[model samples]
Target: MARQEPLVRAASAVRTVVEQGADDGYAGLEISGDRVLLWWKGAPPPAVTDTARAAGVAVEVRAAEHSREELRAAADRLWRSSGVEHGGQLQAVKIISDGRGLEAAVRPGRKSPLAPLPELGVPVDVVEQEPPTPTSRCDDGVPWYGGLAIRPSGEWGGACGGNENLRYTCTGGFGVHIGSTEYLLTAGHCATVGETLLDGAGQYIGEATLRHAEHDLVLVRTDAADRIWDGVPGVSDFTKPVVGWVWTFPGQSLCYSGATSGANCGYTVVKDEYTKFCYEGRCWSDLIAAKRKGRFSVAGGDSGGPVFSLINNSAWIQAAGTVTGTLQQTDLLGNKTEWVIFQDFGTATRDWPGLDTINYLDPM
Candidate 1:
């Protein structure tokens, strides 16, 4: 219980703003370290600040003139307006700073240089970032070690793939419902409905029956959910079932475990929402991203893995979401890095309508 004190306090303060209604300029909320961030559609009213200032935890109130979704659509239109060759290679789009505007990325070194985004009555910035290298990942086979497919005998997080010859593996946060229904959660792009999920030893476990691309999720139906285990290679111990999960925050500490990689710990969330990514030329928004504080966050085949946070010194854990993809970035100085992308459980919950108790791995 003591472990939940800070988060409990933050949630209370956040509710204070959420309860105020849209008339008060509050459009969105996210936690940032010790503070709760209340993003208003315009300048924050005095009552909002008064509530934040007096709250036990620190608070940040900012303005976003328009909702992030609106800006996301506007960004899409901006890209379409370009209509030039360069726009075709553009990777992703996202709202920037206080939701005041938008930013986009294009293939590095513009052989087909793109013009500045036309006036959209909002701040817009176009930057250069390399498009992820597109290479054929599958051709009549799948990697058994990817996506942390389950292994029989009560261990999990092995590899799950597609039924088509073009199999691509991805991991999902495992869960249980009722006394018999079992499920595995992951990104929609990882696999589709009816595809069989395999374990470490290549035994069939379940099939994906639900998916929500807008939410970046795919839910697989399984027979039994005994426990949630992570495929961290060489690490025998892992967390047990999830106790709970916190909302995404600007600077909240978080971690993840993928089939391509083991559990990655100690990183800060850059922003909570309104993030965007493109898959196979289809662009989507509303995602979470985190940087690598100690090690790389995620990679291919790691999609649909677990994004979680720990409490009580690893004695308890919470499931945030399944891995979506990574944001491969190239800074102005040409320095390249990648951050893990995730779609939290709050969104995944939509796929399963009334299911309770999300079972996730906890360190033992």
Candidate 2:
């Protein structure tokens, strides 16, 4: 865990420079095994490199083809022009972490006219890939912790509108406080505002108070605590206290839990600021992508579960993000794997200012 401090300090310095609009040609930043890699389109900025060095960390500046801002603009233009074309064939779009170019994922065997899009100033690398689908999960308990299964009230065990389809379930995310109101976090696509959430045993959990469909995040005002279930339901029941939240860096290790899949680890961060096209022609952006190592780490009904990393190999944990869905990507060997994608808590706090996980920092 101590190895993360230098990476954190270096990231802070780079973030400060970008936030201040003094990034120069900065493209992105990543933590690669205790070293900070800063990608820039042209000459590396002395300000950011010097600041990061002064923070007592090793920093490497690499040349990039395009800046993050440029890639984002290019991606937006491509989406605007080709999002609804060919029945929404475009699956996803993101800036290559190494700043090589923009990556546009389209449905396999489908033709998309993405190359001639006007105002797409940056280079685009098109690939055939399937779009990710939203997943939703569980446990039993009080003070309602994250990773517990929750479903819409009145639809959990029954069919709605004369169909045998039961309501889809979702896993609770982190417990957060917006002002004095306590709320449980979950995937917005799981339920709508004003819908009452219930546990598997038919107990009232809370009512969805806030929903952000674009980011796939929802807040439920309820009785909750700042902890995540550490054990799998029907097997064991334990929890770890949430100390605070942390930003996700590529190559960092993480673990996630859901009612359907329980807890799975050995996941590595792959990318951030990804925009995935989902059902109903919608696209959710600013998502973090983590690759699974072994057996599937995510499945249907795992949406809104907690994604975190252990702190100092102890029971305490730092909040990372909330599961959104899984993406299918092919490797150089042409092997396809389902990757767990999540909405970063950092984006959550930014979207809802003053929002924070109910943690040890709170008053007793």
Each candidate's lDDT (Cα)? 0.57, 0.74
Q: Give the top-scoring candidate (TM-score).
A: 2
- In lDDT terms, how accurate is model 2? 0.74
For each candidate, give its TM-score against the true structure: 0.74, 0.86
Candidate 1 per-residue lDDT, tens place, 1-364, comes to 2343465446545654554452344556666555566676866666666666676776676666776556666766765665233355456666653566776666668635665556777676667665432101111112121124442223333233332322235554646453356566667766667777665455565787877866777766765342344435334424345765555655567777765565777656775353456655655456777776333446656667677776666655666666777766555776766677777666655456654444444322
Our tally of clashes for model 2 stands at 8
RMSD of 2: 4.3
- Give the lDDT of residue 175 in candidate 2: 86
Cα lDDT tens digits for candidate 2, 190-294: 889999998766678899988888888999999888888766654665678887777777777788887667777778788555754555566677788888644
lDDT of 1: 0.57
- Predictions: Cα RMSD each: 6.8, 4.3
